[model samples]
Target: MKLLLIPDKFKGSLTSVEVSKAFIAGVKKSGIPFSSHYIKASDGGDGFMNAVAHYKACISVQVISENPLGRPIQSYYLYNQESNSAYIELANASGMELLKPEERNPMLTSTFGTGLQIKDAIEKGVKNIYIGLGGSATNDGGIGIAQALGYSFLDKSGNRLLATGASLSKINSIDDTDVFEGLKQIRFFAVNDVNNPLLGKDGAAHIYAGQKGATKEMIKELDLGLRNLDVVIFDKYSFLYAELPGSGAAGGVAYGLKSFLGASYCNGIDFILELSGVNDLLTKEKFDFLITGEGRIDEQTLHGKLIQGVLALGVRKNIPVIAICGKLDIEKKELKKRGIYDVFEIQDSTKSLDYNMQHAADLLTAKTTEYFGLLLK
Candidate 1:
């Protein structure tokens, strides 16, 4: 039997590659003569660097940037020569991971470092850039990024604005002449997973600001700031990005890219799938079973995710596809109805969270072994 295992990062637990290893160990222990293929997968979230780094000769460059709390932090950008472009997970520089529990203030954070990464790629003579925006820790409406890219925001008094979300209220004018000075030949693609706009109730500040540690008052202020920035940006470009899908991504970094940098926005999975040649791989291989997974299997899995994307392909190929999750939440019948043929949860019935995390591979290995035993029958 030929089996293909493609899984996303298990988030806070196992990586997709590690999970594949456990599956292989299980299949081997089952005494089954099956050809297994491991394909590390990501949906433009945390494991992007790993996916790209595995198959590409990625060069890393270090840069100084600000953390969520306005403190200095060191971050790195990865450049791929095969594509003649540089890739960045914007979160690497300004992600929520850079902040402590007490320092998760969205109003004060900035996407400045993300912009610096863009500038770095430009300096490298890269005309095409791929940027993934997830795990952000800011709500600056991309003002800081604009600043990093040579765009200047001035107050009514003609003073430059501060590089924070709170400072957007003072912005009265935008000067992009210097920002646009470079060759207009560059093409940028912003990879984002969310479709929230830049403002309004379902927008960036209201829907996501609370998760970034913003209070009701702060959310209001951040929304206002983004609204004001939208107005100023529209005046200069004659375009309004406030309502563009994914414009709210990374605290409105998507809006900044569209309004100022003329960047195209695409979902992270689509971009990664194309870059990794997923379609080509599928066309070249015919498998008896397709296995896709993530850290958790729940209602959210119905949303556009790596698991769903993989299953879509499997369904088209008329192959039975199973999902292996770190934990399973929804009923199995429901998952099956959603095109998941089978679901496996890797929790030790009698283990602690820490214990499960540490021994996940072994536990998964054991479970996969038993699962393959049935397959052999």
Candidate 2:
């Protein structure tokens, strides 16, 4: 049997590479003769930089930057010397994973840290920057990033307002007197999978703020803040990013970058697959089955996630695709309709969430062994 394993980060547990290793261990333990190949995959989320760096043999450059709360932390970006391009994943600097559950608050968090990473890359003389926008811990409408790039938000009183979700509504004007000089010379690409606009019922605050620890009231406040910021931006820049596709990505960082830095948007999965040359590999390689997975399986998985992208490739090549996740929330019929032959959950029903998370690697190994053992019969 020949198997191709491509998995995304498990989030709070195993990374894609680790997940592949566990799967390989299980397949070996099964003692079934097989040739296995694996590729680490990401949808331009948390582990995107690592995947890209590995695929391109890029150099890793680390710099000190602030976290979402303005605390100092170290972050890194992948530098491809050949292309003079840098790949930076926002989650590295402004991710929710850096905060404890109790510490998560979108109203207070900021993307300034991510902006600093971009600044650092520019300072290194990179001509192009690709920012992976996902796993953010902020809902500031990207004002924090603008602030870091030398744009100032001022209130009606002409006093500078701190760049954060709470201050979005107080903005009376934008000041770009000291904006980064090299910005116009650099090409910026915002890579993300989300398609939500910047504001509204299906937008940033309503759809993602809850996961970032926003209360019901906070969600309403954040939504209002985004609206207010949009008004200010339009008045000053003569452009409205409120309804732009993917404007809501990374808590509106996509919108901010597009509005201020002239960033273009790209589908995260497609871009990553192409950059990693996985698209070419799919054409050259043949396998009995393709296995891809992420942290969870749900309706959202159908919407441009790593699994969906992988399954699309499988469907095109007429390959059987299987998914393994920490949990499963979608109907089997729905998965079948999408070209997934089977879906496996790593956690046992009786296990506690903490227990499941702690034993994720081992559980995955056991599950893979059991599943393939059956196939061998």
Candidate 3:
């Protein structure tokens, strides 16, 4: 049998490459006579650079950037000199994986570091910048990035406020006079795989901030802050982005990008899959199974995430699709409706979360072996 393996990173645990290796190991142990083709998949999260590099000639440009909490860290983005373009992953700097779970507070984190990388690209005279807008740890609505680009958020007293989720409600005005002159000339694209709006129950704060370590009370506050920001942004720039699909992505960073930087949005999975020539391969061969997944499988997976994209491909090609995830929260009925035949969750619930994350590769291998071994034996 021929199989196709493509999965996102396990998030703070196995990278997609590592996941693929462990998966292959498991399948070998199952003693199922099978051949597999591995694709290092990315939906605008950790392995975005890998996808871009696969698509073009590019090199990494390392820079000293900051973490989500303003801690200095080493980061990099892919730069294509031939096209004078840059591909930056927000997760490289402002990602949840960078922090301990206890330290993941949306109200405190910032995307300033990602912005620094963008500024660097622009200063290098790069004309097009694509920013991966998934796996972010902040809910400040992209003001942190705008701050690095020389936009200022000020309160009624005209005192500049530091860009964070807590400050989103305090902004009385915005100033863009000091923004990089080349900003308007550069094309900005927010790449993600979600279609969440910027406000209300289905919006960024209400839907995503909880994962960024916000309590229910905090989520409400952040949502209110985002609403306040939406009004302030409209008052100053005459732009309304809150209601746009995907505006809520990356803690409303897409909304912020559109409001402050004039960014366009695209589906990350579609872009990467097309760029990596996976579409061509899918068309040329009919694999027995197309396997895809990520760290968590939940209701959100239906909302334009990587798995959704993979499922779409599976339906179009009449291929069976199996999903593997660290945590599985969706139902069998839901999976059936999405054209996914099965899902395997690899976590060992008896172990502490720390243990599970630490030994994720081994756990995944064991789980895969158990499932396939039992099924095929």
Candidate 4:
């Protein structure tokens, strides 16, 4: 039997590369004479630049930037001189992983760090910028980024405001007359997967802020701030983007780029897979099963994530897909109905969450052995 393995990072557990190694070791324990292939993939999250560098030649340009809470940090982005383009991952500077649980209040965080990275890239003569909008820790409606690029957010009294979620509701206007001239030449693209808008029930604050340490009251306030931001943009540019799909990505950073820099949005999974040549590989080889997964297989996994992209490939290429996850929250019947042959939850339920995370590799390997031992034999 031949198998193709593709997995995403298990978040706090194993990396995708480590997971693939565990799968190989487990299959060997099964004593099944099976050949396998691996695809290291990303859906434009934190590892976005790594995925692009895997298939293309690019230079890593390091910069001094700020963390989500405005602390100075060292970060980098991929640059291609030939295309005069740079690829930036928001998580490098503004990700949820950058902050401790106690430091994750969106009201106090900002995307100004990411904006600094962009400004550095622009100063380096990059004309095209692709930013992956995922795993951010802020909900400032993009005002922090705008501020970093030389725009100013002002209160009703025309006084400059600090760029943070708490200040969003106080922003009465934006001043961009002093923005970097190079910004006008830069073409920006937001690589996104989620379809949430910038505000309201399914919007960034309501849907994602809780993950970045927001209380219900904070969420309501952030949502109000985003609404105010939309109104201010409409007043200035005659354009409203709060309801735009994917605009809510990265805590309204996507919305910020679209409104401030004329950025466009693209599908993250499709872009990354195409870059990694997944379709070309499938066209060349016929595998019995395509194994793919991520940290958690939940309702969100069905929407524009790497698994959704891999599932589409499985359907198109007529390959059975067996997905393995560290934790499974979706119903197996639902996945089966959607054409996945099976879903494996590899954690030991008897163990504590910390224990399961620490031993994820062993659990994944054992699960792999059990499955292939029963099926391949």
* lDDT head-to-head 1 vs 2, winner: 2
Ranking by TM-score: 4, 2, 3, 1
Q: For residues 44-159, what per-residue lDDT tens digits would candidate 1 score against the true structure?
A: 65666767777679988787766655667787778877778777887788788878878898878888877877787787788788778777888887777778889889999889
**Per-prediction count of colliding residue pairs?**
0, 0, 0, 0
lDDT of 2 by residue, 209-310 (tens): 999999999999999999988988888879977797789988888898899898999888778778777667777977888889988998878866789888
Better-scoring candidate (lDDT), 2 or 3: 3
The TM-score leader among the candidates is 4
TM-score of every prediction relative to native: 0.86, 0.93, 0.92, 0.96
Give candidate 3 misplaced runs (Cα > 4 Å).
348-355, 373-377
Candidate 3: clashing pairs of residues: none
Candidate 4 residue-wise lDDT, 137-221, digit = tens: 9998777888889999999999999999999999899898899887878899999867788888889999899999999999999
Model 4 per-residue lDDT at 270: 80
On TM-score, the stronger of 1 and 3 is 3
Error of 1 at 211 (Å): 3.7
Model 3, 279-372: lDDT tens per residue? 7898787799988878889999888788888888788888899999988897867888767899989999888889988999999899988978
